[model samples]
Every structure is written in C-alpha cells, then in structure tokens.
Target: MDIELYHDSKYGNGARVAEEFKRLAETKGSNVNIHHVREAGSKNLPRADLYVFGSPTHFGKATRGIMRFVKKLELPPGTKYAVFGTFSGAAPDKKTGKMPSEEELEKRRRTIPMIDEALRSKEMAKVAEMRFFVKPENLKGPLEDGWQKIVEEFVVAILGK
Candidate 1:
C-alpha cells in the first residue's frame, strides 16, 4: 500500500514522528511519503492507500495551520486515515487555571472536535480506524511505551491482511 503522512510540528517533533511513522510503515512493506505541512503546499500528493495526519497539539487542538492544512488533506471517497497529537497539560480542571493552555481555552476554540470530526468524514470518508495520543509539549513525545502498540494496532487493523 502507498501511504502519505502529513504533519505540522512547531518544535519539529511532528516531523520526527512523521519520519518514524514512515520508517515503521516502510518496514511493514509500504511505499511511504512524508510532507512537512509547509512543503505540502507546493506539491500535489499522489493517491495513497492510507493517509495519516498528525500535528503538535497546540491549545487542545491541532494547530490552526495544521487544521487549514487538513482541509487540504481531503482524499477520495473511502481513503483510509488516522490521527495523533501532542499536548502539555495536567488535564482539564473545573476552574480555568491562570494562562489556560491553548488546549485549555482551545486557542482556535475548535481543536479537538474539529480534528476529530475532520478525521471522521473530511480527511477520509471511510476511516478503517482512528487513534489519538497526548504528550507533554515541553517534555516532547510520541512516547514508546505501551502507547506504541496502540499506534501499531491502528496501522495493522487498517491494513488487514
């Protein structure tokens, strides 16, 4: 299967994750291509059997830039897709804490639901399956604990033999 990975990383970890995903996918036997969200603008992507979208979670949602980029991630009907994100927070609190992280106030005010909904129908109408991960922004992650299995499983299920 041909796979395309699109990502927007502020600290460039998003790209690193995209590269790791491509490497892993390649070992699994697929021709993979990764485009930095910025570079994605100049080139038209080839038709891919699978499409994975990722971004450094900024303010509880994908970056506005990434979200805009996702509008471009739109694929033909039935294209398979998945998603992942990175964020820094203790978790939501009952009272709005001072500074309210972007994920807290939701900078774009439409991060989670927008990406979730987009992956549901916009990016790929027939998502074989989907996945989400949260990592501390300052700590840097795409951590490889039990979480690795979650992503691997998502890929395996989507590419059922």
Candidate 2:
C-alpha cells in the first residue's frame, strides 16, 4: 500500500504523531510519505491507497492552513482517507479543580470533524479518525503518554495488517 500523510503542525506535536504513524505503517511494508501542508500546497496530491491528514487543534477547530489545504484538495470522489488531530484536552475547572468529562471535550473540539466535513464534501470515504491529546498544561506538547501506541493502532486499522 502507498500512503500520503499531510500534517499542519504549529508546534511539532502533530508532526511527531504523523512520523510515528508513518514508521508503524512502513513496518507493515506499506510505503508512506509525510509532508507538511505548506510543502504540499494542496496541488496534485500523489495517488495513494490511502491519504492521512493530521492537524493541530486551534480554538477547537483545525488550523487555518489545514482547513485551506483540505478545501483545495482535488482528489477524485470516493477516495480513501483518514484524519487525526492533536489537542490540549480541557484543563481542570478553576472552581472545582476537576477535569472536564470526555463528552464535554468532544463537544468542544471539532478539529477532526472540520477536516472530515471538507473531505466528505468532495465525496471521499473515511476509514478512521482519532485524536491524540496534548498535555493540558503545555499546549506545545509532550503528548499525553502512550501516543505511539495509538498511532500503531491507527496504522493497523488503515493498513489492514
């Protein structure tokens, strides 16, 4: 399988996750190419068995660069794709000192959905979607522990090996 992975990483956390995904997919004998959105510029995206897009969450949505890239993608309809996002999950409530529930966080973070919407508009088929959390205290993260394992799972799911 051939895969093209594009990412918009302001602080490099998303890039790190994309690299891990690429490494895992390559181990399964799939060819994976990684590119930054700026480098790719949404033109003539190489054909691949699957396309994976990653973005860092900004104000609960995908960064402007990624949104623009996705909107400009010209891939044929019914193309296969997956998406992932890196976010600093909600911090503890100031009053209660308790972290927000996952349900609440899901409602607040729409990064993956934003990307998925653009892809769906172009009639692409989604294989999977995931979110990797950044440490709440450090938005430019050391990702939440075990993020590599999540990437491994994603690689297996998309590559089917």
Compared with the true structure, the alpha-carbon lDDT of candidate 2 equals 0.89
RMSD of each: 4.8, 1.3
lDDT string for model 1 (10-111, tens) is 666556556666666677888878877777762366788777777766554668777787665546666677666654534444476445565544553444
Of the candidates shown, which would achieve the greatest lDDT relative to the real structure?
2
> Scored by Cα lDDT, where does model 1 land?
0.62
Full-model lDDT for every candidate: 0.62, 0.89
TM-score of each: 0.68, 0.94
Location of the lowest summed lDDT over 10 successive residues in candidate 1: 129-138
Q: Assess the local accuracy of residue 89 in candidate 2 as a C-alpha lDDT between 0 and 100.
A: 57
